[model samples]
Target: MPTGPTIIGFDADDTLWHNEPFFRMTQERFAELLRDHADPDHLMERLLEAERRNLGHYGFGIKGFVLTMIETAIEVTDGRVPASTISHLLNEGREMLRHPVDLLPGAEDTVRQLSQTHVLIMITKGDLLDQERKLAESGLGDLFDGVEIVSDKKAATYTRAFADHGDGAQAGLMVGNSMKSDVIPAIEAGAWGVFCPSEQEWALERADPPVAAPRYHEIASLHELPDLVKTL
Candidate 1:
């Protein structure tokens, strides 16, 4: 095994930039729009259920999320949700898509510094166009050696990504906020997994940390990443 990772993969969403908070804000708006039909807590539960069910069909991203919200609205209101409410949900998604890419403190600097030594790749799963747009707007696009906007972050996906980057699993490292999507999968694939917790987390992405995993590491923020990678 390599002394340290030869190729480091970063999860684009919450790991590097602001993401879930926007979704949360949108969800709040959605709840307000449907307040008369259902209690906020109940509506949120239904919306989450709709999102979970639609994941297989639409995958993850703003578009699927918006559709799920619409579905939830229709269901919660018994198909009586007004067209105006549906339009509001659609507009919320549009606003989210147009939201600026706000890089977490030190995210850009860390990537830039690491790119000078090791191969840096972005391993994010979401709507292709939206992810691509964020990447382009982030202005750190040139620093990444490769980009993988996958449908899911499974072990097989990480293995393939590592291989495609000219490295085996043991020579790769994955850094992200979600233990479920970013850390556990990479660790299962024989790569080192670094958990960098984000301020906001989606319920679906939450998972217990793999504390027993020898290759698993956790950092408070992206700023701590460079030092951790150096020790690896």
Candidate 2:
């Protein structure tokens, strides 16, 4: 009956299109705006701390990042950070929101080809509206059988997603750049996990991969995905 993955999960953001570069650009601006209060290195550290601490409250995406930047600015400056710096940070976030979605090479083709044989589910975590906007703009939105913009990627999340959308986790596969969020959780949920490393991923997303897992796999990029899926 089932040969390989009947349900394929694709991670958005860095996997489908460009994402980290915008965040990096905004971080640069954030550091420049706060240069007077803290050096770039120290300010970035504080920003990261704020992001890590605020994830539970803010969840994820541009809006939360802006809030973290503003919070970090006030903290690093001892509440002396100027309103103009805060305003600049806000504008930078808006720019990130407005940035065009640039799909990774062959990302569309891979999704399209796979959709011919497998049910494709987009499982990504971020601000709901922002994720929707990016997907709508990327033109790959119509290709996915279903879309899931969850708050976080966990084993339970993948288990439910695969169960609802396909035969079950055993017949599903998750492909993404994050070892922590995409690969690890999918494998834990009993689906295949395909690691597609991007040019740059967030430090928080890094994890020692599940190399010993019989279902775990690593690919150079999303372009390699369709062929690999054929073998799975």
Candidate 3:
């Protein structure tokens, strides 16, 4: 494999490390707390609805997650919830915050390999402090020459990344699990994209399939990336 693009952007959450499982654990505990007031499935649905609606107001991270649990408790329990339950919810949210970070298998090796031939950047979106902490703990922080931890990975971010990094489209590629956030914007900005799907990315966060001649490649694993890069 030969170098495909000079600059390759990788997503950080589930794409590079373990993330969604912690959120799912918190949600399950939330349902348990509210089970007396509502069915578990109904509680989950309502909680998800609140999260979607509150994303604009609260954004992502522990703060938004706490609000979702509080709001869900009030809604399902008709504001009659025990004070202890609120305490429990807060504790759970904090526990979510303290969950130890771990990287996906082979992430370090794959990133290291890709870095040998191409410039590597970590392009991730999340609460600033939490994202930074995770990156620091991953032990691959030094591997990335540049890191873009933004609130969103929209078209403008991709454009800036390309322009700031090098000459133009030919030099950049975006790789990640979310098609919506990672691939589409990169492609729209005239950069190549590599899609590596994860089981738990937000469905709405996915990018639609390319409408024009393909400017992206879909891969199964980061370990397969060396071969992909060779062909690029």
Better of 2 and 3 by TM-score: 2
RMSD of 3: 2.2
Model with the higher TM-score, candidate 1 or 3: 1
Taking the tens digit of each residue's C-alpha lDDT, what string does model 3 give over 1-232?
A: 3445778888998889988888878888888888889999888888889988988888767778888889989988889989999999899877877777888876899999888877888889878888888989888898888888887778789889777765555678888888888888888888888888877776457557675636778888788877877776
Model 1 worst lDDT window (10 residues): 162-171
Model 2 alpha-carbon drift over 4 Å, by segment: none
For candidate 1, write residues 116-177 as lDDT tens digits.
98999999999999999999999999999899999989999999999998577889999999
TM-score of each: 0.98, 0.98, 0.92
- lDDT score for residue 68 of model 3: 81
Ranking by lDDT: 1, 2, 3
lDDT per residue, candidate 2, 42-110, as tens digits? 888888888899999999788999999999999988999988888888889889989999999889989
List per-candidate RMSD values in Å. 0.9, 0.7, 2.2
Clashing pairs in 2: none
lDDT of each: 0.94, 0.91, 0.82
